[model samples]
Target: MTSSTPLPPEGHGLPQEIIDTIIDTVSDSTTLKACTLVRHDWLPRARQNLFCELSFPPATLRGEERWRSDYEEVLRSVVMDVAHSNIKPPLSAAVRRLKLHFTDTSSELGFLEITSQLPFKNLHAIELLDSDLYRFEDHDQDALFLFLRENPSLKELRLDGVNSEPKKFLHFFSRLAGLQLQLRSLYLNDFFGYHDDYHEPESTFLHSLPLLSNPPALQTLALHDVSRTEADIFVIPLLTTPSRFFDLSCLQSLEFKFPFIESDEAILKMCGATVMRFTIKGIAHRIHDGVILEKCFHHLSNLVRLELHSVHPDRHGIVLLLLEHVPILRRLGQLSMQFVKAPSRVRDSSPPYTSAEWALFGEGVDSKVDQLMQTSNPSLKHITLDIPCSWKNVTEERIREYFPKTNSKAVLEVFRIQDS
Candidate 1:
C-alpha cells in the first residue's frame, strides 16, 4: 500500500519501417518541410524528398539582378550559399537528381556557374534545359565540366533546348567521350536548335570525329532535332564501327528524332542484338512507307521498346515521347508501335472524319504491338504518345475516345498510347 502507483507503461514509437512508409507517401514540399522540422529522425526522409529533385525555378531567375547602390548591399551577401561545402550534409548528401532549367541568354549565368560546382557525391542524374552554357568561351562551361568530373556517380545526362552550332555541339560528344563512368541514359534535344530551316549545305561537324580516341559509355542515346544524314554518315559510323577500330557495343536504347527518316535503318540493324529500345519521331514517312521498319526491326530480336511518334507540335506533341527511358534497364522492358504519315492539316481542322485520324493512329498502334510480339516478349511495356495538336480540331477528350482496347490480346488493358 505504501508503494507508489506503478509508473505508467512507456509507449514505444512507431516501427522505423512504418515511419519511413508514412514519410514516403507525403510528397508535397510544404508538408515535407514540416515533417523535417518535427524531429531529427524524420529529417533524413524529409530531406530525401526535398533534395531529391532540386530544380531551380526556370522563369523566376531568368533576368539579371538589378544593380544596388548602397554599401549595405555588399554586406548583405548576395552570393548563393547553396552548393557550399559548409551546408548541412543532410541536405546536400540527400540529392539524387538535379534539374537546372533556365532560359536563353539569361543574365544570371553566374548563378548557374556557382551552383553547379558544388560537390554532391550522391548525385546520380543531371538535366540542363534551355541554357547555352556549353559555349567554351565562358568560365561557366569549365565550371560545368568540373562539376561533371566531380560527380562520378552520375547515371544520366540530358541536354534539352540548348541552341548551338554543329562544331560547338561536337565538343559535347568529345568531352563525354572522356568521362570514366558509363552513363545509363543520355538525351540530346535541339542541342543546336539546328533546324531544316537553316539547312546548312554541309554539316562539316559530322565528317569530323569527336576528339575522343575511345567510345563513351552509354546505355540509352537519344538524338532530337539532329540531322538525319549526319546521324547516318558521321555519328553512327564514328560511334559504332569507328573506321576499323572497336565497336561501341555499350548502346542499348537508341533513338532518333529528326524531321525525316533516311536510309539509316542498317545502322539500327547493326546494333539490333544489343539495342533493346528503338525510337524514331518526325514526319516518319520512311516508316509509313514500310521499308524502314521491315528492314530494320526484324533483326532486333532482343528489342524491348519500339516507339515511333509524330514530332511536329502543330500536328503532334511528343515530349521525350516514345523513349520512356528506364535508366537502370540496363531494367529490361517491352513496347511497340507502327508509323503513319498524317498531314498536319485536315481541311482547316473542322474535325473532318475525327474517326479517320483515330483510325490511322489506331492502325499504327496495333501494328506496332503485333510487330514487337516476337522481340519484346519479356520487356517492360510502355506506350508514350506525343499530343502534337493544340486542339486545332480534335480535343484531348476526342483523342481518348477512339483509343484501342488491347485487353484481350495481352495483359495490357488498352492497345492504345496513354498520355503522360
Candidate 2:
C-alpha cells in the first residue's frame, strides 16, 4: 500500500525556525490563513496571530451577525461550549482583547451574554462603541459589574460615541471606583451631557472621579469631544477641589482630542507633578485662529515633552502663539510642527512647513519661526519644520537673515527642505 500523506510545498519545507519566523511576521488574516495550510507546525503560531485580537465588522451595520467576520465563527463554537458548561477555558482564553461596536440594544444584550459565558480570564482590554449606549448602559449595570469583577485583570478601557447622563455611568464606575482593577489607561471620547436634561446639573460626573475610592492612578488618559459636555465642566474641573475625585494624580501621559483654551492649564493646575508627556490636537477647528489656544498653550507651565499638532498649517502662528505662552520661560524644548499626519494625498503636496497647497486651507501660515526663535528668555534647543524643496532656492544669507546663529546658545534649525 502506498503512503497517502501529502507533503508541504518546497518553500514550506523550510526549517521549522524559518517557518515560525514567517508566521510571526505576518499579522494580516489572509496571510495567517495561508500559513496554516503550509505545514502543521506553523498552525499554532498562525492561529495565535489570527485569533488573538478580534474586531467584528462595524456594528453600525443593521444586523448583529454582520460584525462576525472570518475568525468569529471559531469564537462562536467556543462560546457555545462555554455556555453549555462543557467549557474549554483555553479556547476563550485565546481572546485577550475584544472590541464590540453596537448599532442597537439587542447587540449589546447578545454580547453581554457572550461576555458572561466566556468568563475570559485573559480578557484585559475591552472597547464599547455605541451612540445609544444609554439604552443598555443603565439597564445592564449588574451584568456589567459582574463582567468587571470576574475579569479583575482588565487594565485598559475605551468608551467612544457614548452620550449619557453621568449618573447612569456612575453606577458602573462606582463599581470601578473601588480601584480594585489595575486600570492604567482610559479613553473617554465624544461623551455628551444628556440631551434631555434641560437642567444640566453644575457638575455631577466631574465630582465623582476622586470618590472612586481613590481610583487607580491612570497612567494614560485621553479626553475627546469636550464641547459635547455643557460648559467646560468635564475638562476644566478635573483639577479643582470638591470635584477632584476622578484621581488623575498618577497620570504620566495625557492627550486632548478636543482643544480647549484652558484645558491643559486645568490639568497642570490640578496635577502637574506627575505628567511628563502632554499632547493637544487642534484639528477640531477648521479656522484655528490662535486666539482661543494662545492662552491654552500659554499654560504649559510644567512638563518635559509637549506635542502640538494642528490641521491648519495656515495658522502656523498658532504653534508660535503657544510657544510664546510658556511662562516657565527657560525649560528646554524642541518644537516640532511639521510632524502633522496629513493623508498621503496631502503629504504629496503639503511639504511640512511651507506649502502653497495650504493656501486653500486659509491664507498660508505666518512665517513665525523667526518670531518663535525671538521669544524672550528661551530654552528652545531645536526647531524642526518640513519646508518645501521648492522654497530651498533662497540664498543662505537670507536664511541667516531670519534665523541668525548668534543666540548665546545657538538654536539648531533642522529642515527637511534640501540645500539648493
Candidate 3:
C-alpha cells in the first residue's frame, strides 16, 4: 500500500482574492460558518460576511411570537461570544448595519438597552421597524441617543410604523442635532404624530430649534403613507424652510406617495431645482384630474429620471399628462412605469381592464413615445414597463403590437413582477 499524499500547507491552494470572492457569494449561514474553519487567512473575510448585517429576531421570524424567544436567546449568545472571544479583527468591527425592532414589552426594551452598549465601530445604517417611541422611558431614550452618539460613521436612518407625540418627535431630532451626526438618507413611512389641530404648537417648536439655522446637508429623502396633517406639522417645514435638520437645496433624490396635497407642492418647488431623480407612488385613477398634479410636475425642471409606481387601471391618461410636463426636463433620460394588482380588499372595487381598454391605453402611450422622440435635443434613452406576472402575457402582447415605433428604436423593455 502507498502512503497517503501529504496535505497542502494552510492557505496554499486558492489565491486569497479568489477565495474571498467565493466566500462573499455564499448566502447560507451554515456554509459560511463551515468556511471559518478552513484556514487562518480565510477567517477575516468569512467573519465579516457573516456579521455584516445583524437583525434581531431575524427578519425570517416575521412577528411569529412562538419563535421569537428562541431567536433572541441565540442572538444574545452570539453577542456574548463576540465580546469574550479572542478572534483577531473582532466580529464587532465587522458589523456595518443593524435592523432592530422595538416593542412595548419590558424584555424587548431591555434588549434594546443591551444592544446599545455593544462596540460597533464601523456601523453606518440603522432601521427601526414598528417602534413606539412615545412609550420609551427616559432611560430607553438615553440608550438610543448614546448609541447614535457613539457611531459617528452612521449615515442612514429609517423609521417605519413609528408612533410618537409631537414633543417626543422634536426631542428625538434635537438629540440628533446635539450629536452633530450628518445623515445621507432618511425614510419615514406610516409615521404617526397625532392630528392636524396641533399643528400650531408643533410648528412653533420645530422652527424654534437652534440648529435650524445651520442644518446639515442631506442627499435623499422618502415619505410614504404619512398623513397630510403630519406632513404639515413635521415634514413640510423641515424641507420648505431653512432648518438645521435638513438642507433641501442639497437633496438629490425624492420619493413621495400620493393623494397630492398643498404641502407636497411646496416641498417640490423648493427641492425640484436640484433633484435629479423622482419617484411617485400610489397613483389612483381619480388623481388624473387634480390641478395639484399638474402644478407639482412643473417644478421638476432638472429631473433626469422618473418612476411611476402602482398606477391604477384606466389611469393611462396620467402618464400622458406627466410626459407633457417632461418637455421642460431637457436632461430627462430614463422613465419607468410599474403596474400592480389592486389589494385584496379593494380588488372588487376596481375591476381589471378589458381588451378594448388595453388597446386604447397602448395606443395613447405609443403616441406619447413618438411625441417625446420628436422633441429637439431629445435626451430620452430608455423606458421600462413592469407588469404584474398575472397580466404579463396580455399586457406584453398588446404593448408589443401597439408600440411598433418604440420596438423599432429598441429602447423599450418589459419585466414581470411578482403579484404581491
Which one is best on lDDT? Answer: 3
* CA RMSD, predictions in order: 9.0, 8.7, 6.1
TM-score per candidate, in order? 0.62, 0.66, 0.80
Give the per-residue lDDT of model 2 (tens digit) for 266-302: 6555665666677766643544445555444444445
Q: Tens-digit lDDT track for model 1 on 1-420? A: 332333323435565666778887885478778767765667766667666776654345434344222212321232234544353455457778887655443424364455555556678888887766434445656666777777788888888876654444555555555663456677777744343443444335444544445544567777777556445433454455433222446578788764335434655656667887777666433234334545555556566665655533222322222222222233345443433433554332223335435434432433343333334343555543444333244454454444433332333422333332
**True-vs-predicted CA distance for residue 283, candidate 1, Å:** 7.7
Q: Assess candidate 1 and give its lDDT.
A: 0.53
Please list the residue runs of candidate 2 whose C-alpha ends up more than 4 Å from where it truly belongs after superposition: 1-49, 58-78, 81-91, 107-111, 131-133, 137-139, 195-214, 231-245, 261-264, 284-299, 317-320, 326-334, 338-367, 370-420
- lDDT (Cα, 0-100) at 100 in candidate 3: 77
Say which prediction, candidate 2 or candidate 3, comes out ahead on lDDT: 3
Clashes of each: 10, 5, 2
Give the number of the best model, judged by TM-score.
Answer: 3
After TM-score superposition, the amount by which residue 344's alpha carbon in candidate 3 deviates from its true location, in angstroms, is 9.4
Worst 10 residues of 1 by lDDT: 67-76
Could you tell me the lDDT of residue 77 within candidate 1?
36
